[model samples]
Target chain A: MEKGGFCISTMASSNIAILLTIGVITVLVIQIIYIINRSRKPLHSKSPRSLSTLIVLGSGGHTAEMLNLLYVLQTERFKPRYYIAAATDNMSLQKAHVFEDSLLGKEAPEEVGRAEYMQIYRSREVGQSYITSVGTTLVAIAHALWLMIKIRPQVILCNGPGTCIPLCVIAFLFKVFGIRWSSIFYVESIARVRKLSLSGLLLYKLHMADQLFVQWPQLKEKYPRAHYVGRLM
Target chain B: MGDIDDIAKEKRVVFVTVGTTSFDALVRAVDTPEVKNELFKKGYTDILIQMGRGLYIPTKSTAENGSPALDYFTFSSSIADYLKSASLVISHAGSGSIFETLRLGKPLIVVVNEDLMDNHQSELAEELAERKHLYCARPQTLYKTISDMDPGSLVPYQPGDAKPVAELIYRYLGFPVD
Candidate 1:
């Protein structure tokens, strides 16, 4: 009777051990799957609908290129929300229109116009001068600083001459702050001598961007860092 | 900008936006005396309105406002309105404009911007024109191209499903998605 009792106790203990082992293994497997799924989901799926991209739109051609890029991003495997920082007086309405009308379950980029942002320079009228208002410029710089602190995009894709200078400066700062950032410029068309004024010089230097997309091959020489993306038209 | 809109309301119109860069040479070629004469001969422009940046001697011209930049939420609604209203769209060789034009199935004539330091827009415009997706005009031939283009000749736009730019961003960021 004693031997039989001892045998029964041993068997019961082994069974409990086996059950505990299985339970632990099951729990671990579930944890692994949860982690995998969390990683696979959109970065902001849990967070508020934050901007994944800060795309700056220049007055004309650059606006178009950036819009096209937005469309491309909407269809990509990884969709991140984007915000448009258009140049002052730029009527980038058409590109915005395309985004609003996409059928591919792509939401158009949210417009964060220059209103809240101050113009660095004041002009008698919009587009009268190529320069930004002092207020607007300060606002842009401040916005960049704010974005680094708040929105904190993984990368910035800049497409305009107007904001390239601002965006690049911010991006460099972000890199220093241990945030990863990259930039892209659209050479929608080539530069001319007459268009090569002071701001133009600044813009040209700004075009020494991290990654430049030029429609023409000659632009490659001017910007060794540029990639000839075969005319983004 | 206001003037163009005010004038456009009264006439049977053709809307042109060649973008904001100075592609003067290309515009000049397409709108050459010969080209303008041809278009006039063809009667394509009952009224022509040119917008954005270019130096074309239009039968009538004004820089149409792009649409006042608005916050994204509101601007989205207005952009659709502009696209629906444009009758015949003439645009620069910018991909965004072309894609929008194609997507709308609007009659389009793309005049490449050649006056830039480099002539990339010309090449792109030509390649696309060769595909029969759009009509290409140089500045000197602008009038001739306009003359020859039938409102019906604006070919339906074709698109491929590749997100190269987005992919580039994702890959750089080490996202698992393509």
Candidate 2:
């Protein structure tokens, strides 16, 4: 009777061990699949295919330069383009309207209207206290995340500005999680002659931008990876 | 005296614009009694200032009734019109103001605000000055710089065609610019 009990106990132990091994293998296989899927190039990385682009318009000079850059592109190719600015920056929205008018010129009014304008709360304002900045930054992040999910843009473009920080961060997080839906392009303002602006510095250090363009050659030397594209404005 | 009258009769307009940001230092520098006297002596009849959000308002009275020679507003949408009419523009070294002033072919004196963190205004001022497109002045040297400006020597600003900037952006966006 004791021998029979020992045999049964040994069999039960082995069965438990076998089940544990199978569970480990299953977990390993699942992890391997996830990693492989994450390693895969993003769907939009296939080629220079036309894509929906989100252009972030900062206040003042940033807005002007972005408009100039947009004017240079084949607007027809970047179908379903979107322009975003800070909530307080109605001037930028007006400017975007002017750009839309110029680009559409007598084409489809419906399509012209489709080029949407969005506004997010500014992350920081000049002279804002640090506490206020933190509060606004959190709000901006939430707004940016929502916008990113909704827009699902293939490309995002911005010149250096405080307002662009949250959007870029969300884009980077999306990329890391293999969402791979959007690519960020940062252009240093023409006003930056010698060194990177605050926004440029952050994006450069974090490797958030896929392509960084500097208007001045000297700036490219400071940031070797930055493409020394000539003045944009 | 006769020359002053002749200059006054010419209706020379000087536009001191702080752009959309306030720079109390600049407004203060321009508002000094010495500076006002110098400007009046130089025959500046009208001064239109776009103060933006600056706290300091000009307190000096005008030559007539001490009513303040400077007329300032918090903001204006018709800045381009003012730029076109102004013979000289004194502004903080903001790119927007500089470019607009240049585009209008007006003589510009940019006062670089060095207090701001990593300010690029000084560099911009230097580059534009080197190009003979405008003059740059520091807050300390502002009065001297403005007093000595020769508007006749200012080279008409010619901006590069927007084609290259656009093309670069197009190429960056992965579109072939035909």
Candidate 3:
């Protein structure tokens, strides 16, 4: 009698677990469908409304290409910019400032400083081993979570960079919670002629980015979702 | 800076840059007698190399050794001035280095770093080379590339504009056209 009762209890618990899994999966599918539909909606406003923009700058070539992309950026619509770089990358931070100064060089005094720059810890440094990066990755995620919550940006832009992953995840979480939809625009680096960068791959696979731009036409062919809008740099 | 520009104008300079990374094989390849002799024969009066933290130095390049006036530096604040001064540029397959040189209308030979796992830059170099914008070579074939390069035969690369991208982004975000 005891054995039979124990088997029944175990079977009931297993059934409940399976039902819970299905429920979570169903909710996820619905959320994804809703988000996709929401992004497709043509938003129209009578007056010029601005979005608080977030730009993540990676080191060296990534920063160079992003600056080129920003060269023709319509700053009027994407104002009050926020720039994020990795903590170890001091040069990228300096370059960002220089680019900002040049951008607002001719503007009014009050509008001179329309951007904010911040740095976050990297999950893995260049040449770092993957084994130890798990610990740092969690740290980076926590810090990114804090920044994403604090800024609550409406638009997120990043090219090829490792730093964008954590922030994009948090932005995605915010979207999932229905707090806000921080539309992500991922631009594949011009250097990536044949393939997507790791960050690009992750965001593309997860459908985290609302729009993904590939510079190379062949790359666009490989990744159907990517829009081939010509090379930016 | 003005003096350097004036000096560069008089002497044909071939600037070799690894572009902020250690490509020891490339540095070692260009530092050889065969490469130096080839550059000298091409009427390149001077060769300036930005070695980029590489341990090997091209010390064999000297007038006594029948090579052109050669000099190398580890790093520079900006390589734009160097690109501007160069009549020819042989650079690592970095897009920034490639575009900078091409925009200046200099003949270029891009040397691909085979050690790197990412083969994307190789495609960029190869594609541009196929279009006759620049020549592409590995460290091993650099000597032959330098010998056969015809700067006159190449066409200048038309740089792509970023304005379309900006417009696309705005449109994708549901912003209406004015």
> Largest TM-score belongs to which candidate?
3
Q: Score the docking of each candidate (DockQ).
A: 0.08, 0.35, 0.54
What residue pairs are clashing in model 3? none
C-alpha lDDT of residue A107 in model 1 = 35
lDDT: worst 10-residue window of model 3 chain A: A39-48
Can you give the TM-score per candidate against the true fold?
Answer: 0.49, 0.81, 0.90
lDDT of 3 by residue, B150-170 (tens): 889999788888777787777
Candidate 3 Cα errors over 4 Å, as ranges: A1-25, A40-48, A109-113, B1-9
Q: Residues B131-163, candidate 2, lDDT per residue (tens digit)?
A: 788999987788788678777888887664446
What would the per-residue lDDT of candidate 3 be over residues A28-91, giving only the tens digit for each residue? Answer: 8899888867655434445347888999998887888888888777676787789999999888
Sorting all predicted structures by DockQ, with the top scorer first, yields 3, 2, 1
How does candidate 2 score on lDDT? 0.78
Off by over 4 Å in 2: A1-49, A109-113, B1-9, B60-68, B172-174
lDDT of each: 0.50, 0.78, 0.85
